[model samples]
Target: MPSKPLTTYVTHQPMTAVQVLEKAAEIVAERYFHGDVFCSAKATKDFLTFKMGGYEREVFAVMLLDSQHSMIEFRELFFGSIDAASVYPREVVKVGLEVNAAAIILAHNHPSGVPEPSQSDKRITSQLKDALALVDIRVLDHIVVGETCVSFAERGLI
Candidate 1:
């Protein structure tokens, strides 16, 4: 007698709205955060917005990239209150060095619906750019995610 071919079965479990959102975010990150897939400013903005847009407080993060500009990791380095987060250049540089990142895209979220880069934001970006420069890591852009996303590179702030 001939044996029947076996078939694999799969099941789909129902997920809540938050769980679905989280799963979608995970899929987006997996697709965009690897290889040179983050090739456009719009793509980067979308990824950063998804990652930081829902926060109630300030969150400072970096997208560590390899020499080929592929993402190495997305790290949230600092957390703070509604308006401010203490970003340390030394720590940022350290993380870049530790991961051997050749470039970085900085990101932070404003709790208010405003995406404008404040004077403080500008100053920190400048500081972080200068600090990362010493280690030969490029500062690609500084993105402020709020109601919309703002790119420092587009504004020529980087």
Candidate 2:
């Protein structure tokens, strides 16, 4: 028997961690594109859950949307400790203006994996809603992501 040299093939580029995440986020965003109204609470929750569910600390993010509810951008605005984050409405409003977003879906992960909105969550949602309303921006939903996502809009909190 004759010895044969091993053969190998490289069909795709090896992606970095960040590149992989970016590609995944792009795919998630694509699911919301083919619609007149991008206001499906379940879909929004599902999408956000995939994006924010695996954090060890808290991450506050927003899905900025145009007037017709199409995506303008998805941004992680604040990073915090395992249990708490100081979410600034001014900064959020600034990004909304910068992106020219007409509405936003707020999300944050509970690293503890409970997915329950605490008192602070309720308070901030109210504050953010009122603050954004001042600038003619709408807060469509706030999703608390953990093992599962809990939606404020679905519960009539938004």
Candidate 3:
């Protein structure tokens, strides 16, 4: 038999590590979050941890939800240095309005591997809650992702 060219054997390009992880996250989100009712803090924490835990820098994300608490969207809205991500209430509200979200769950990753909510986190959560309230959008919880996930609501902070 004649030797075939290598090009004929390659059907697709390989995925980078990041691409693989992104695809995996998408699969998990579709299976676990999309159109699913909010049931427990542990579930939320697990999802957020999976989504945000691997970042080397800070990322602020929002889980926009419907009136029935089904997920509308999960968006990473802000990026920052290894230590902090600037979260803007107005921008968050704009995203919420764009999605017509009835509620939101906030989440961020700490590159420092600490899951404790900082004072700044508390302040921004308050600001976001107030801003979202103006449009009748509820702020359900704020989660900090690090070595583990911490729920602000669980700590009576929300």
Candidate 4:
């Protein structure tokens, strides 16, 4: 029998949501918060992955914002076993209350590397919109972040 060479593969790490967003905020604040710098989807995803490490499955998050739309908190609310995560409107509302968030920006990752919102994604956003409306919390945007990120408010999808 002939000897064969062994192969190795790189493994990715994981990080908390706060770590990811803090880096993003730092980057945005450093170059674009009060300036004219443009942040593309690729840039955002790179920043997140660099700070938090790559994700293996889908994860949904909520970025609580103040009245000025600045980030107050980054929360990873739910983790899905596969490509989809279950989002509870009531739980989201509770989180909004707990954080005293005047507005929120929702985000989720697609393990498949596609950032386009599915029909279910839109439906969930609409539901969350209606639920939050009851409590007077505005949904500033729903952003899907993966290989790319799309913003509902930016694209007028919402």
- The per-prediction tally of clashing pairs is 0, 0, 0, 0
- Candidate 3 residue-wise lDDT at 71: 87
lDDT of each: 0.90, 0.86, 0.89, 0.74
Worst 10 residues of 2 by lDDT: 31-40
TM-score of predicted structure 4: 0.72
Estimate TM-scores for all models.
0.85, 0.84, 0.87, 0.72
- Candidate 4 C-alpha lDDT tens digits along 4-41: 98889989888667667667657754553232222344
RMSD (CA, Å), each prediction: 5.1, 5.3, 3.2, 9.8
Which residue pairs overlap in candidate 2's backbone? none
Off-target runs (Cα >4 Å) in candidate 1 are 1-21
lDDT of 3 by residue, 1-158 (tens): 99987665657889876676678767766676645447677667777777888899999999999998888889999999999988889999999999899999999999999899999999999999999999999999999999998899889999
Pairwise TM-score winner, candidates 1 and 3: 3
Which candidate tops lDDT?
Answer: 1
lDDT of 3: 0.89
Error of 1 at 69 (Å): 0.9
Where model 3 places Cα greater than 4 Å from the true spot, the runs are 1-7, 11-17, 34-36
Residue by residue across 1-158, what tens digits does model 2's lDDT show?
99999899869979866566567666777866546546577667767776777678999999899988888888999999999988999999999999899999899999999999999999999999999999999998999999888999889988
- In angstroms, how far off is 116's CA in candidate 2? 0.5
- The positional error of residue 91 in candidate 3, measured at the CA in angstroms, is 0.4
